[model samples]
Target: MSQSPGILMMVIAFVLALGPLVFLHELGHYLAGRWFGVKAEVFSVGFGREIGGFTDKRGTRWKFGMLPLGGYVRFAGDMNPGSQPDPNWLALPAAERARTFQAKPLWQRAIIVAAGPIANFLVAIVILGAFAAAYGTITIPPVAGPIKAGTPAATAGLREGDRILSIGGREFDNFNDMAAFTSMRAGMRVEIDYVRDGQQARTETVIGQDVSKDRFGNEVRRGVLGIAAPAEIVRSTVPVWQAPIVGVERTFSLVGMMVDGLGQLIAGRVPVSELGGPMRIAKMSGESLSLGFESFVVFVALISINLGFINLLPVPMLDGGHLLFYAIEGVRRRPVEPQVMEWAFRGGLVAILALMVLVTFNDLGAFGVWRNLAGLIG
Candidate 1:
């Protein structure tokens, strides 16, 4: 069926977003592998035959391909570009097989597989740091700024200095996230968990209109409980001694959150619709950029971390899949049967492809493509 301009924009935006993200992710693998004396034979930005490329000094043929969906790094002795070991590699001299991935120490192998996602997280941190250094940080503490005496919040017993803990079941880390939530809807009643006098607290708030005329000469309506945040960050940055600590902690926490989110998704507590494909990400980045360069960079960083986390999930035909085999070998003292592993990998490819289709459509619907198409048709 024919679509609308909005739908087309979303598609274009999505491809643009995914292209770089996928390329960088695979680049991480390529660089890290090469650094460790592992030979990367090919570095492809996308799948299928090479559309454009040049050979590097180490015989690594770097190329761009027709498909922008995915990419791979082909290591020496690999069965394919993804670093899977070849039978011929095993048949070679013991010294030769020693250079293959299957011959590497489990620790080294894990590091190589992990480097891809690690690169993503690193990208996020650098982007965030650069943005933070440039634009400074924003701080919105939970302490209520002020509630107009005649407003519903004041009348409803909401008071200033009340520390917000959670809203709509999501824990509020700071006032910034709270503000983001509040800005989404107007006149929505919400149960807010908070702290009163540094003790346990609970609140039910009926959001009222915080009326204002927006910059576009239009009345912009948004949810407001008449809360205000202090406009400052104190310029928080990792000290030289603490950079790694803070970065690692943040990375760990993000991983935990991603895992928790996945668990919730699998349990049906959170819908798969919450998942964002390239289209959603691009739209988000564009919006964030409109807000500020810092916001755009930070959003990209966050997306990079998300990309890293998802790729590392223990699914067959993924880096995690190879790690899984190594893990099994460590425990059982033998590699998984080649035939079984091959079949499992085939299934994995199928699963991954199916998921891509679902997410793409989800992205279209998310951007309201169908509605726009309907409007066009009408």
Candidate 2:
């Protein structure tokens, strides 16, 4: 673990890391809306009271806000910034209806809703592709070095020198991929395929959870297979033409890891306290910056993927929520009632707020705020 920077440095690092990614996400929605002939009322990089902005010729107001933690693109006829439909949209004259989001066909609407996450993925892929083209990747054979007694690997009959071939049918070309896959699957059963000497074998094992303190003293739960990688590592560089393909592979690997972690959290295998909010992100941003540019870029990619995935959750007040509603609309042959949308969005808002509070409390604890207060009382 590295020492976090000064408060000011951390703030700067957080803004630098999060702001652009948010802007890019909103940009995706804005562009898609424009392409589909839907009018955007505002393109904002944050929430709350507006700080500054200018309306474009197309009547889109581009602005910044006091809070830099999140952003949105308010399409025309949206009730608020959440993309909720406005009744006034339906009452508008026929000409005005042409540019409203609600007037668009279902498929076009789905595309606009999905574009934000797609943009984040695109950014990750491009950054990763650039890295691959520049430095290639360090490859390590997925050979087991040591097996800890009484652990999942030992119980599953894994031994030293067993070459890990795959997990859940996905083959690994590097130890790093295997490690990430295993770590994200705490308390989940996974099928492992490995080769020993002249024979290949398969085994089903329940991944074990290992609890450890993170750099900021927060309890972190990760899956452990109880096997270590061999000492040797190899750097394998691919041709420039292959960089993008390799980048896609790397991105998908991360996506799987995120999905597994979320599943573990939902299944109660990982505690909800493990959820980190803005302060944790800020600290990580500063620490990653200290590690050098390449590490920072990698961190950005992870966060980007996370942002994309989070938005796709089927909770209201998020893009995914809207998509869920659209899915029902597709099946029902009509929009969900506005009253239903309102209730769903309200519930989602409450859930999002509750999560924010939990993570913020965890962040304060991680930053030693409670300790400082105790010292003051003493």
Candidate 3:
């Protein structure tokens, strides 16, 4: 079966956006494996049945697959495609066993596994840094603008021209910093330090929650302080030398946001409905592409950071799971038993599959698939 033009375009765009990131992530594992004297048997750009491939002189088979979702690298002595250690790795010829991933030193194996996530972060930093250097950034002072009547800002005595100095001990030079901080603390009371007419003062206010919808009609709830930015705006051209620094700062800031959101979710403060999956990501990818190259690049950079951070999670069947095993080995002075590793990976696979189902259901709802179906049936 063939897809319609619109569907095809979405598929292509999704691949273009994700393919490079996946390739780089897998390449990190391959290159690190080679560096540490482990032999890579296969390098794939997707999963399932192979579409096309060629063997290199070093005997690595590089191939593409039908599924465009993600890719993986298979090292020698991998028990299965998922890279579990083979029980027979010890029985192989000494020369061949020496080249197997399981035979490598603990540090080498850990590096090989960690290299994937590290590459993702590096790619995001480079893309964001390049854009920052080329296009610069916009800035507005943290001075208070007109407070919305009957809102939290007005209730807390925030007045026009009051310059925001800090929130929760974090100082800011731009309104964005304060806004970012405030928006994340919905329903939480915090001390806001500011200067009104050159007199230092502090006000405690609980951030108000407002529910709004995006262009796609997805509901979003955010903390609204009922404060607006000053009328004046500033645009500054960042030097190439400083762009990377700015990129690093921006990357860390985004990571912090993710951490905060995860913490909120775990604490039962945030609803699970806000979580999105592949369909939501595809819809977002198309929307971002329509917004132009800069917006799309920024979106990609953000996703890349997320990819890096998520892979570092200590879940089985992920890079972080492998690292966890290595950590245990380091502490216990021996490798985790192959049977235990197998069961862990199996459990991880089940957990991952369940998560996928949940997120996909959420995506369908977010995309209004059920609503549209109901409308048609009605």
The alpha-carbon RMSD values of the candidates against the true structure, listed in the order shown, are: 5.8, 2.8, 3.4
Q: Output the TM-score of candidate 3.
A: 0.91
Stretches of model 2 off by over 4 angstroms after superposition: 148-157, 165-173, 185-193, 201-220, 232-234, 371-378
lDDT of 3 by residue, 1-378 (tens): 311225555565677788888999999999999998999999999988999999999999999998878899999999773466687888899999999998888899999999999888888888888988998988899998889998888999999999989886779899987887777668877789999888999998888989987664557788888988899898889999999898888888788878878887787667788788877778777767766778888888888888889899999988999899889999999988878988998999999999999899899997678889999999
Reference-based TM-score of each model: 0.74, 0.89, 0.91
Report the C-alpha lDDT of model 1 over 155-212, residue by residue, as the tens digit. Answer: 5576777777887677877776676566544566778776778786776767666656
Per-prediction backbone clash count? 0, 0, 0
lDDT of 2 by residue, 191-251 (tens): 9999999799999899998988755445667889999888878888878899889889888
Better by lDDT, candidate 2 or 1: 2
Error of 1 at 180 (Å): 7.8
The residue pairs in collision within model 3 are: none
- Candidate 1 ranges with C-alpha deviation above 4 Å: 1-20, 80-84, 145-158, 165-173, 177-194, 197-257, 285-293, 372-378
TM-score winner, 2 or 3: 3
